[model samples]
Target: MKILALESSAVSASVALTEDEKLVAQSFQNCGLTHSRTLLPMAENLLANCGVSLADVDAIAVAHGPGSFTGVRIGVATVKGLALGADKPCLGVSTLEAMAWGARALGGDLCCVMDARAGQVYNALFTVEDGRVRRLCDDRAIKLTELAEEIGEAPYFLVGDGADLCYNTIKENCTGLRLAPAELRFATGFGVAAAALPLFREGKACSPQELDAFYLRRPQAERERMARLAQTK
Candidate 1:
């Protein structure tokens, strides 16, 4: 199956093409540019350079959420637009799960995290065995102390934008933690494709309208609004 995947859940944005479980081509950028400006262009360039077009793709996939609200929306909207235009199915994989796929080479307890700010992170636990990622928990927003307690002494390789922050904050208490190298640390388009492949095989792909963001927590704007209402009460 041919998959075109997109990732813009964090500061970086990337597009990847994969076929039969192998990466064909990928374009990645982390220049602090807005994803709305860079993502689609990157996808177009990646496909043109690789001689593959939207019609040739079997399914469009993206890391749907639990990261930047705007980034997640951009990624999901981009994939939805592509899938709708091509009349193709969509695979919306978890942002944390996509990062797990990226760290599969490490092969052990995988702690996927993204900086969710305010002493918390968007996290999910997974264990990779024989090149397959198995989720141990649902995606969640968790405090570092609680996450560390959950990981207690079971060696975990941290992967995601929050790895450095998590490693430093919890390392003194959680001795079994190690950070993934910079390249494999963050979410990627290739990882999104890799995560989507299993779902595709399992017949989990959905229509363009079915694809949706997966933010673990409410958006900041909504939270602020609620706080203001509470104050008024």
Candidate 2:
């Protein structure tokens, strides 16, 4: 299957094209530009360079949620438009899962995390065995201390944009934790494609309208608003 995937769930954004399990073309940028400006252009450039358009792609995939709320919204919205326009299937892979898929080559425990701020991270656990990723936990927003306790010294590679923060916060407590290399630390378009292909084969793809963001918690503004309301009440 030809899959076109987009990733903008964190600081960096990337677009990738994959044929079956092989990544054919990818354009990545971590230059601090707004995803709205960089994402579509990158996808267009990647497809154009690959000599394939949306019509040629069998599925449109995105890393949805558990990172920047605006970033996840942009990615999911982009995929929805492209898939709807091309009449292609839509794959909404978890941002954490996509990171895990990208690091499948590490072949051990994977602790995917994204900085969710306020001493918390968006995280999920996965184990890669024989080149396939098996999810160990549902995606969640968790405190660093709780996460460290749950991990309990088992050897694991930290992944995603928050790897460094997570590692530093709990490193003393979790002796077996190691930071993944720089290249494997962030979510990428290729990772989204890698995570989506299996779901596509399992008949789990959705329509454009059904594809949606998966933020683990409400945005900070919303939380603050609720807090204010509670104080007034």
Give candidates' CA RMSD values in order.
0.7, 0.7
Model 1, 1-233: lDDT tens digits are 99999999898999999997899998899999999999999999999999888999999999999899999999999999999999999999999999999889999899999999999999999999899999999999999989988888889999999999999999988899999999999899999999999999999999999999988888999999999999999
What TM-score does each of the candidates earn?
0.98, 0.99
lDDT by residue (49-153, candidate 2, tens digit) is 888988899999999887899999999999999998899989999999999999988889999999999999999999998898999999999999999999989
Candidates' C-alpha lDDT: 0.94, 0.94
Residue clash pairs of candidate 1:
none
Deviation in angstroms for 76 in model 2?
0.8
Per-residue lDDT, model 1, residue 111, is: 94
Query: Given candidate 2, what's the lDDT at residue 227?
Result: 100
Model 1 spans > 4 angstroms off: none
Consecutive 10-residue window with the lowest summed lDDT within model 1: 147-156
Root-mean-square deviation of Cα positions for candidate 1 versus the true structure, in angstroms: 0.7
